[model samples]
Target: MSWLVTGGAGYIGSHVVRAFIEQGITPIVVDDLSSGHREFVPDGVDFVEGQVQDTSLLERTMREHDVEGVMHIAGYKYAGVSVARPLHTYSQNVQGTAAVLEAMQRVGVSRIVFSSSAAVYGTPDVDLVTEDQPTAPESPYGQSKLIGEWLLADQARALELTDGATPLQHVSLRYFNVVGSGTDEVYDTSPHNLFPLVIEALIEGRTPRINGTDYPTPDGTCVRDYVHVADLATSHVAAATAMAEGRELRPVYNLGSGDGLSVREIMDAMQRGTGHTFEPVIGERRPGDPARIVANGDAAARDLDWRMRHSIDDMVTSAWQARTAHPDISE
Candidate 1:
């Protein structure tokens, strides 16, 4: 049986697809290609170009591919942009997730691995965030993600209450600051993302700017958890495997590093990785920016085999290697 990977052609989704392929599992892709590239879907993989909101299309794709599970990664991911486009964000994330779940129920596919975000914690007051942390999303994107988790939980419960119904086993992986490229063929194309923005500026011979430098962190800039995309992909695969093997799993897990790196530390790694020596220009801190928001991934470490396998240097080096190899990313 194959798994349907929504947004399988996107950066993190593409890595998840590769991980599934490497493990000899068949992956069928359904992506609209709004921000994702078609070429990112590897050769020989079944690809269907469509939005997640189209329930008819999703049901057809699952039925045709004999999909037994889903890895839901398709959504509008721009936090800053979502502030201006709240309706569009809900349309894509909230409504779109509801559509995916509806299609899953229609096709009787019960297993899912949701791609969540730490944005749900919004400017967390504590230094270390845990799964039990109060969710108080500040942005439309974050609210949408939290709502998506609720939809999944409610659906699972609904299924459990149905007579002769198979309980929907699912897990949501919340994370922050995903960077680095698992392969040169696919890189983060987000216009608002930090790593890509820095790499692009450096490649174009322009100095990258830091948003703020007055935070309470060691270097003044904000500190946040950063995890390698490959490691995140591995945990996704592990979650899927555990579900398929009938192993008990948590409803939610944080794919995070207990310790985090400040923006200054990231800039230092980028300089060493890209051979750029220019200092970053500091700009006014964006509104609602948190000083520090790291998470304890001990739960995932024990269950999903999650670990910080790559350092800041390794993340920068691999990301730079891919960025340089794919010069068109700067375009």
Candidate 2:
């Protein structure tokens, strides 16, 4: 079946694309290449170099490829940036998602897999967050995603003008800390996340920036669950397969490793994995960063029969390998 994967050349999107390809599925990629690298997109897959908000372009791509479904990974995801530039985040994330939904309806493509975030449940009272947990989005980034989710629902039910009841079903996967790399061909270009920033700092012989050293956690740093990209990729396959088999309604699932690891633990793991002794500088906290946020991914496992096979060590090691192999994230 033909599928459209927005941001398919990006880190997580590429993994999903590769996983789909391995299962004898052909996916067309739509990436504007703003933050995503072109090298991540494999040869032979249909690739559209454009943005999700480009409605005419999206319609053309879907029509040309006969796209049956869409996997929307196209969004601005930096929490700090979202705080600084709320309008831009909403425009790119919320508005872009709406456009994708409209284009999907116009093209008669039904299913979508949304890449949501654990940040939606910002600073949960408990570390392990379930999908039913209250949404208290801390930043515009998270709020925009929440808005996107609402838009997805509206699109599915055909509640708006230009409207007709759509067969469009969506599965929003709220994931946390997508780390590790299956291909050395693609490494993270943005150094916002903990893993890549730490690895790059070590390679450059500089101290890594560890935000907020005064959290209530054991190590006094914000704790998070880091899920391996490969494992998360498997779950994406599960989502696609579930929809392809005809799940009637839209569902949301949380993807996580079901554990919490602190910044100290992450530093130690990176040091061990990269054989580097670089320490991180504990600066002031990043604005809108929650104290501790982990995932209670039992719902996904229960529904999709998905489980994480890679450990935290595996995530660090794989990321370390890629950083060591290509320190600059270049081909």
Question: Each candidate's TM vs. the true structure?
Answer: 0.97, 0.95
After superposing candidate 1 on the true structure, give the runs of residues whose Cα lies further than 4 Å from its correct spot.
Answer: 328-331
Prediction RMSDs, each to the true structure: 1.2, 2.0
- For lDDT, the strongest prediction is 1
Q: Which residue pairs show backbone clashes in model 2?
A: none
Q: What would the per-residue lDDT of candidate 1 be over residues 80-171, giving only the tens digit for each residue?
A: 78888999999999999999999999999999999999989988888899999999988899999999999999999999899977789899
Query: lDDT values of the candidates?
Result: 0.91, 0.83
Tell me the tens digit of each residue's lDDT in model 2 across 214-313: 9999989989888888778778877888888875433788887788888889888887887778767879999988888888888788766568887777
Report the alpha-carbon TM-score of model 1 versus the true structure.
Answer: 0.97
Q: What number of clashing residue pairs does each candidate have, in the order they appear?
A: 0, 0
Lowest lDDT 10-residue stretch of candidate 1: 284-293
Candidate 2, after superposition: displacement of residue 325 in Å? 2.2
